[model samples]
Target chain A: MNNARRNRSFLTDEDGSAATTAGFVIAGGLTFILLAVVLFTDVPIIGPNEGEMAPNLEGQIHTLGAESWTNFELYDEVDGTWDAESNPEAKWFLIQFMDTDCPHCWNEAGPMSDIESNFGDRLTMISVAVSLNIPSHDSDREEVVAFQEKASLMGCNSGNSDCSTRSGEPHDWAYFDDLDVTIMDTWGVQGTPFIVIIKPDGEVAWNQGQNQGQEIMEALVEMLPVVEAA
Target chain B: MILSTTVVLVISGLTILFGALSRTEALRPLFSTLGLGSLVDEPISRRMIAGALGGILGGILSAVWVWVIQRQEIIGSTSLCIPGSGCVAALSQGSSNNLPFTGLEFGLFFILLFSILGWIALTLHLDPKASNALRLLSWGRILSGAGTAVAVWMTIIHLAFVDDSPAICPVCLVLLVANIVTFAQFHLLYTSHSNGSWNDK
Candidate 1:
């Protein structure tokens, strides 16, 4: 009987609950603030963040007149270790992630072709075609070829019979087929018409995702050397 | 993966045995019928519950840190998922449609839930005489059991449904082990407290 009474008294004490509650409250509040800051801040670490080394991209390259798809690795042509000052031939790379079905990509096709025509001497442009995984937004190798051909028709080369003429200039660059969509995931591309400008040294100079409400053309014009009048 | 899963199952089974045998007299006859009556009288320590809670808290915090790194796009040589690894593939598979944010939200929810439960359990353990402490501790046991169940179910989903390839999230595996160990500890606490064995210590 005495033991039972001692146990009952021991189970009713309220000594340290207040301190525990206060500690938890403070810790929880601090954790919340930390997570919020992490989510909102622009930390350049990976996934197309500006000033970071762009992730390596590889895909199947389909040229406008090619008989078969060929392998393409971005880093193979634009060496990550190549310095512009050491190698004057080092060319800037303009990578555009697009879907054949996206309307924004469709509209940007002409402007992108024009950019390639104007800056073809100083930079290399490549269009990475990907599927958005939505209804009617899907694309394949044939669709990629067709999209590039259409864009090419807008260029100075109007002799190609394979493509229907569009409003934009013809695109002379290669169109890569991201069949597995791995490129999209690597770059953290959320939507189509995503543009990234890689410096000659392979560092990401500009990422459209990081610069919301800004046009890729505006960024390119500002960053690229001014075209001299003949 | 098989070895770890087997170890977790064995530990969980032992936890259930101790939980069933330590307190209720009704379970005594059931164990006796199976010639396991001798195990019922075995004395178990309550001190391990604190250790188990500590492990859970640490494991959850580590997982939250990984989640933060992933969300912040802080990928480098030291990141949890390297390029071309299973972790990267799993992350890529879920990147569509803001799915990573959903994962972050869920992780935050678990952190809050476990943190609150750990605090309550610690308070009850330290001040067993606190008003209604025993009752609240019992609720903690139930909730911890539920939390463990959720962890198990998620592990199953990750193994069977996440992808065709066998991809394991190391952080997720740590969370599972932590949840199971904490649940077992809670059971041990219940066994010791109900029989008044904790007071002897």
Candidate 2:
């Protein structure tokens, strides 16, 4: 049988012993060299390449038009729809692309809430928090929720006393969980706290840089009628 | 998840080690059922095989722990819902985002490198056609020993020094046993060979 022959040959293979002894010496030598290298040097084994640049679209102008807003499927905060339709009562939209940990995003919350309250029914304000990979901060969903809670952006404390005691107009807050920033890319948002005002007809009216919350609202008032007419 | 996986791998390593040391023909059947019979063919080969398996699993599990702790950096977004909104948004520069070389990632790479070396050693042991089987076995022993040292060092640094845990991890303790047995088996083999007792077998 093949098994018997294999067993007999395995026991009688005298050449293997000498070769194994040689292999031992070579293996010992190689291991010694490897250990020395490990002990002496600092090696980078996993992770991103060095000198990578952070994506910053600060001060860049976007030539976006009304036709551009047709297929944006922002993950819904309520219905969980990928392309959740906006409320019919709302005529205009103020979309703010922001990083949850950005100090400027935190600072702009008050001004945005003011605009939401003043424009009531005339305009819908949505804050889209983007996750940023900074050295100290990990801007993710938990951090997004925490930031929303800290700033009361979820309108939890808004006029409605249905859920609990809270204040402020319940602003729409949503984000994309698909890991694709096609919406952000389409808008040419390079920096945090980027604001874009869209007319009811899906035409972009305002694309402003960071830290212009007050100016944005003032500009919105001027453009509201024009957006409504469209 | 990482913690649970580490526990399972550690338990598997222990079973292999215990079976090898006992060398009961009864244990051979059990080991064969698990696809590890040839591994315990002789006193020398058994320890090397166990050490290699332990190192491979330990290296992978520890690396997983590193990834788990830094999920935010790796995946951009988590399922944790915001209190007021139904929206979850994650913005990153690109896929290149978690690629920055960090200590944890680097440690994982090192563990994996040594684990590969341990596998190479295992391969040499099983290769009947290999003329340098004895020499390769020595190398395999060294590789396993080195891998075990790095694994233990990393575990100590991560759990004790870096994370500042009060006790050593049970998984890490199991790896430590595997490491100790590897060296013990190597010593026994060397002594037996030197005394010409190995030839009697």
Candidate 3:
């Protein structure tokens, strides 16, 4: 009996052609839009934001620290004067960009000193502190002075080690005391513990943070052979 | 990274425009999917969903991005993508500093905005296929809740580790927000907004 009732027409007499037509139109429309956006931005200038020669930093770089950095002139600690010329010296130069207030940087100072001492013959480790938003020359000196004083206090004097309390790691004071701190920027840093590795040709090899011990070690070991041959 | 981000941005932008103008009802879902939920309603849930989805998408995007950068064959030990270092450093890089708004943090905002557009459309039963105006949000309002989280993540990677300086591509950030927003939108639409309206126009 139920089967007999079900035999009745399921649809009303109307054909409902409009509904079917609407469905087809929607399907076609959807296909077209997806296709359009997919192709448009591919135009040379509009789509991809690629800029000139992968800028020392990507084009948007207003500030350069960590790995994306290079400068024509620099200051020398031993001579206590400006280098004026950026020389493509040793096979590799470990340039660490530091700031006056960076505590993480001080923490990495030990490993950095180790990198310098162990590889001193083969590599050169130097630090430059850059500040942000402080452009005037006068303010620049004050910033540098403040940074140097802080560094001296940390490096030369043995204190309560409040700075080293975080990890209970021993502070490397003497090493940093010998090395000079140059102010690369004024006011403050865009970010810190900014370290860069430059190749003999003066190209930035790597841009990154601290504690890259094994990574740097392995790289240096492999690199020595190539440098020796050249 | 650049190619993938570009491709998705283009696809989504065109589909969004199409959704606004198309007359056909059947095509709505496909275009809407590409739009990723321009048809639902819900503020909090949408962002929560977008941020969560953005994380997964960010992971995929990161992997693909690192692969492409590596393929460039630029010789140097890339610190960010060197095995153990990978894009994980982007997390740390965020801590080192702050960049003025670069539009990358807009992902979560996009999610919320998309969801809100869906909510109002569903509630009003406007043209089932209507497209919303471009979303506008203040930095402060946008940064309020979930945007803060994405910002935090982006901040860490940008400052402590990653390069390209927290340059948040608007398209990728929008797409990222859309993915999660759409997922939540579709789910809520089917469950709650369904009987409410579909052909209200």
Candidate 4:
């Protein structure tokens, strides 16, 4: 049949075979170029990092004395627009991402409180309590309140019989409940006890990811004086 | 996840090899039992087969790229997207759109399975002596139609239902386009073969 003969001739034809080879070569080359572009390009990230402006965060703040949660926004406290002379009243912000059920966060609570006590005059510490989505680590507003109660008792007078009582002053800082973990996603927090220091002008001075292996206290000690001098 | 990624990569490599060496006589016996031995004798069918395989490869690569970006996000690292660009916004929003498996993962799995079925169909259609050629060709046509339908639905979701903010996901778009092209090629191959364009001799 003519159709059969044509099919046979087409396969044996040198130009046809060459065209197929050229097409494959071009496609393969383009694929390689695309892969290279994806792998090598320096892409900017939206989340917080050292030397970058922190993303604006809005949440419900549970101040220690307040009976109900109050709305809080980061940009309200710290001006986002850069100013050479930072607002003296707008203290440096120390933001902590913690989970009530995390052991590390529990252990770090005492030290974090001590840090707050020392830096209370120079910085405003805010704790953003979040749920890690693990079954055991799931938290609610009540759990956050309970965790605050326990943290308030860390350095209380143990010699007294009423030691269990929350007579001691609670942490003199705002606490926010992120039970939905939306704030965690916004901050790209992968684990608990993540900390970030924001300048009065809203720039991130230090982030846990950028300052690997450095404790929050150490970073504060090293960076706070520089921030004050500036 | 890493293991599955490796498997997909290997399959993609083998498909490319098959397309490139389809005309070699040494490979004839290997595919003879599958009725694909005469693929070397028909230039048009050979090109169609190559096109389909190329689309599969593109889909696999795009899926892998998405998987890598997602892994970076999980580790709290910066993904591959320019700041203030649509890709960055899309990546930020993509975290909230969580499923048990990512969309790219499901797409990869579907395309890999589809590639296997498509290969069998193509070989069957080309084999003039195959007794069940017409029946298998009908199945191929139906499968391709279904694939096209799914691609269109997903494309609609991507374009309209993703979010209020428009997300320009170049990689996701590439993967969807590859899916459409692969199915279109399959439909064409089945239609041509069934219409008796290829000689029975």
True contacts kept of 2: 0.02
lDDT by residue for model 1 (A1-230), tens: 99998866655433445436635764775478467746654444544788877776765787767779886666546453566456655578999998776777776778887788777777888898888777665566666676677633321122222234444655678888885778888888888888899887567888887788987667876876554455
lDDT of 4 at A6: 88
Q: Model 3 chain B — which ten-residue stretch has the worst lDDT?
A: B131-140
Once superposed on the true structure, which residue ranges of model 1 sit more than 4 Å away at CA?
A1-111, A114-145, A151-163, A167-230, B1-45, B72-110, B153-164, B191-201
Error of 2 at A176 (Å): 26
lDDT of 2 by residue, A39-83 (tens): 543322221111111122222111112111122321221121112
TM-score of each: 0.52, 0.37, 0.29, 0.44
Candidate 4 local lDDT, A18-64, one digit each (tens): 43454455456445644664566433344588777676567688876
- Cα deviation in Å at residue A9, candidate 3? 27
DockQ of each: 0.15, 0.04, 0.04, 0.04
Give the CAPRI rating of model 2: incorrect
Native-contact recovery for every candidate?
0.23, 0.02, 0.00, 0.00
Among all candidates shown, the one with the greatest TM-score? 1
What is the DockQ score, from 0 to 1, of model 4?
A: 0.04
What TM-score does model 1 achieve against the real structure?
A: 0.52
- Over B1-201, each residue of candidate 3 has an lDDT whose tens digit, in order, gives 345545645555444334322333454454345455663332332322233233323323332332333322122222223332323233222212233475322322333333333333222232222222111111112322343355455444544445544444343344334334334333443343334433233
lDDT of 4 by residue, B32-68 (tens): 4555556545555555555466555555565555545
Q: Which residue runs does candidate 3 get wrong by more than 4 Å?
A: A1-223, A226-230, B18-93, B96-170, B176-199
Off by over 4 Å in 2: A1-230, B1-29, B32-107, B128-131, B160-201
Model 4 clash pairs?
Answer: none
Per residue, candidate 1 scores C-alpha lDDT tens digits across B1-201 of: 234333533454444344433344454444455455553443333334334445555545544643553453322222335545555433333232022335444344456657766676566545544665555567767877876776666556556655444556555566666666667667667666775445443
- Each model's lDDT comes to 0.60, 0.45, 0.36, 0.59
The best candidate in terms of DockQ: 1
